[model samples]
Target: MNWSGWSIDRVLILFVSLAYLVIGIQVTMFHYRQNFTHKAMWIPVISSPIFLIAGLILTWYNAPWVHTMFMAFMWFGALAGLIGFYFHFRGVGIRVGGWAMRNFLIGPPVALPLMFSALSVLGLIAIYWKVR
Candidate 1:
């Protein structure tokens, strides 16, 4: 979709939905295996909100004031995911070396930089569109 003219509400909804999907996957993994170390599980839990914050800041930097509001809403949703992650991790001890950790180790090296770059590009586009 053309995110430039998209309302903040829509963007927030979309971001939240994505966050939910990620959290849901994590929960499902936990349910199926029931054997993740707290440390492994907490990586995504902690980093997810940080990712949202980064996205929000990028949005604010690039988009209009109205869009910034939506970014805030998205951030809130991400915060909820963080809380859920915290609770899940609290109950479950560290699983040490496992799928989660393996992914964690690999994800940042690959996915994170790509995600940041994509957000950066999106922010630039938002800014360009706003200025135009």
Candidate 2:
């Protein structure tokens, strides 16, 4: 239950928080126009699976069933967010030559991450309590 003297629960907390932090950064970047295109959106979408896989591997190492289940829920929530972004981008792509397409791209980059981060935070807290 310990890794380098840290409890598995603590590691889970750290990893989950780090994931949220990354998501927050992504949201902020999009909100500020640092990354404002369909191509840039893929950065987080591609990185998410890496986070999920790392979390799951750690969970398996620790054999925390509740934590694992919580992670599964978090993964599902993330997937939903990705799907929302996809649709949002799809909408923009359909109107690529139109004047308002730029405005449409802005919504998903910020909104989807915000929604997903809230859900993931709740899920992480639940898992942390369960494991503790």
Pick by TM-score: which candidate is best? 2
lDDT of 2 by residue, 6-100 (tens): 75565655566466556656655664563545564554555555555545555556466745755775766666566656656655556646437
Instruction: Give the Å shift of residue 86 in candidate 2.
Output: 1.5
lDDT for every model? 0.45, 0.57
lDDT of 1 by residue, 21-83 (tens): 465455445534645443454444454455455555543454566455545544443344445
List of clashing residue pairs for candidate 2: none
Model 1 CA lDDT for position 115: 40
Clashing pairs in 1: 36-95, 37-94, 37-95, 38-93, 38-94
Which is the leading candidate under lDDT? 2
Off-target runs (Cα >4 Å) in candidate 2 are: 1-4, 7-13, 18-63, 94-107, 110-132
